[model samples]
Target: MTATLDHTAAPLIRRPAGRPLRQLVVPYLYVLPAALFVAAFLLYPMVLTAWRSLTHFDGISDPTFAGLDNFRDLFADPHFLLSLRNTVIWTVAAVIFPVTLGLVFALAFSRVRWGGFFKTVIYLPATISAAAAGILFSFVFNYDNGILNMILRGIGLSGLASRWLFDVPTNTFAMIATYTWQQTGLNMMLFLVGLQGLPPEPIEAAKIEGCTGWNLVRRIILPMLMPYVVITTLLAIVNGFKVFDLIWVMTQGGPGRASETLAVTMYREGFILFKQGYSAAIAVVISVVALAFSYFYLRSVLEQEARQ
Candidate 1:
């Protein structure tokens, strides 16, 4: 019996003498092109931008070392301060309104017969480019002959309609509303995917225990959908931080810098005003904020997923 066991185990434990050097190096060779691409396009540009931020380059002139002066000047400028504030507002509102509305729509329409039609109509806006959407909303928000104002007059609520894109806070809120309309459908689709992919056993078990309506959703459904929630919220925050095209097309960050976000400010500084260093500084700040959020949130998500 001992001889029989030894013979069987020796056959099972057979090992190769060595791997060929080419086979060992081939995996790394496969990864080399992608690594080079990232280094050239992403990492090199990031390093260059950071270096530019520390200088006084104005696109035409040679760069002169400026240290933190650009940042200091940004804090002192009222327009920059306003843009920062607007960025904060945009990030917060984007996270709240679109995400919440999307989840709500997903839940409400998941079982509806007309859900497909509703989704198509709602998601159509998201398919349009940001610039195109901005142009369309500009016409819709026209002060005089816009459809919104026309509808308001028809309903005898003309007072409610104003220069949507011309006022201070109103312009900001109008743009936010437009963003919400465009974003909500995508969020809804994500949540709907999550909902459809849910494990049915827990839901069936919950229902048998008299868990229904909001209780069932709050207790069982939501916890399972946390991944989608994290994803949409992160996307919303990043998009909010870097929003420029829509604002540029709609208002050009004006009626006097009222609706300027960080991205718009950076563009105005670098391209329009020829302040390359200052724009680079703004770019660095935006990158830092976005990276911090992504790193911490993704770490936490990984930890949670590992435990599960």
Candidate 2:
């Protein structure tokens, strides 16, 4: 009887290994459609863009190999440099302002009565089309008849009035403000979700230990929400770098090129100026940057999760 049992167990043990392979294959089969879609839309375009970057493609003619000439031209263009600077400025300001404001709002809302209502209100902007938001804000920021300037004048702050879309500094600020307003709710939502998922014991314990108000938030809540913070920060950084529509619709890369981002630069190169190859190079650069950021962001999130 023991010998028969052992013989049966051997087959069962061996069968488990084969089952794992079948399980793995089934999951892959399920994912195959998504994988193919990504390959077709994302991977193929990326490879093609990299190839196009090495050529002089004007979209109409056969592409001629340009070697590194496009890159050389990109480096030499002062407008490109200015665009780069403006992009960096936009990214930094957008990330800082929205994320900071989001954190504050998240913390406040978490502790407040009727917080869900406010959260919904704040997040409403995120649902609006960026192009439409840009158009709306453009009217608000208009020099003569804009609501913002009108409010400023009414408040006896007329000196603050300027051509918001035409001036470099003001244009950048207006764009950043618009971006912040749109994104803050998303960030707040992320934090709110994180807050909701937190274990209640630690919070209750902290309160019993005399942790209240800001102390409770700073010492207990903030530390617990680190994962959400990292996620929101990464998202903000990526979005900031990719911002184009609002800037494009609001300023069209500006009176000069004041609010132009890398995305806008790519668009102007590819579509407006008809430098397809150059635009491809710019697109590649932006893709590479985004990939690097996402890789690190995901890695950090995973590591933090493992530690927790």
Candidate 3:
């Protein structure tokens, strides 16, 4: 023998260099358009906004560095406080109601025969544009001749028909209700997808072992669905903090800043008040909050998946 090693112990020969180079280059090429788009649109704006947060640009004027004055003012601003409060309220409401109701409905749909029809009907409202929904609800909640008030008066419960969109707590709750109604479809679909993907064996086994109703859900379903719950909660918080279009259309951050969230505040500061730098600061805050929550949520999801 010429002292050659066993084939299994021998190092493999490398592929031709040009072919490898071409393969590598092709993948980069495939991603080039998306990379460029993200760089130009997402990265550039984010970097610019971060820089602007330290400036004092008023849309028309040259941006001058103002150190942390804008951030300092952000803390003491009553408008900011009210907006934060409302954002917290919306976020809590979304988490407690929509997520819970969505999970309930998803389970019901999974077990029901007519789920498709019900899902379609429930999700139809979500298909409507938020702007259109706002306009429609504006009419629904109108103080004088609105549908809600009319129904209340017709039922001889006029005391409960007070201005839905014009009062403080009522306006905020009314908007939250509308948001929940519109959002139920998305939540339902997400939960349904998660439910359908679950290994049927565990559910069936649990049922066979006398685990039914809330016991099955509490012990088996909820644990598996924790990932989805975290995801939905994260989305709700981000959406709550960023709500603008519908609230703007319906209340214009009004009834005296009662319904304003961070997004509405940013819009008011940037466009209406012409405080571009300040608005950028608010934008940064929103991004920071979203990123923090997303980081934790994704980490939790990865951990859960790894365990599975």
Top TM-score prediction, candidate number = 3
Report backbone clashes per prediction: 0, 0, 0
lDDT of 3 by residue, 212-289 (tens): 999999999989887887777777766666778889999998888878999899999999989999999999999999
Pairs in steric clash, model 3: none
Candidate with best lDDT: 1
Candidate 2 TM-score to native: 0.88
lDDT pick, better of 1 and 3: 1
Question: Model-by-model lDDT, in order?
Answer: 0.91, 0.87, 0.86
Q: What is the lDDT of residue 28 in candidate 3?
A: 92
Question: Higher-TM-score candidate among 2 and 3?
Answer: 3
What ranges in model 2 sit over 4 Å off?
Answer: 1-30, 304-308
Q: Which portions of model 3 show Cα errors greater than 4 Å? A: 1-24, 300-308
The weakest ten consecutive residues by lDDT in model 1 span 299-308
Could you give candidate 1's per-residue lDDT for residues 67-124 as a string of tens digits?
9998888889998899999999999999999989999999988989998898888778
lDDT of 2 by residue, 145-195 (tens): 999999999999999988999986888888888888898888888888888
Error of 2 at 167 (Å): 1.3
RMSD for each model, in Å, please?
Answer: 3.6, 3.5, 3.4
Superposed Cα deviation of residue 205, candidate 3 (Å): 2.7
Model 2 pairs whose backbones collide: none
Off by over 4 Å in 1: 1-21, 300-308
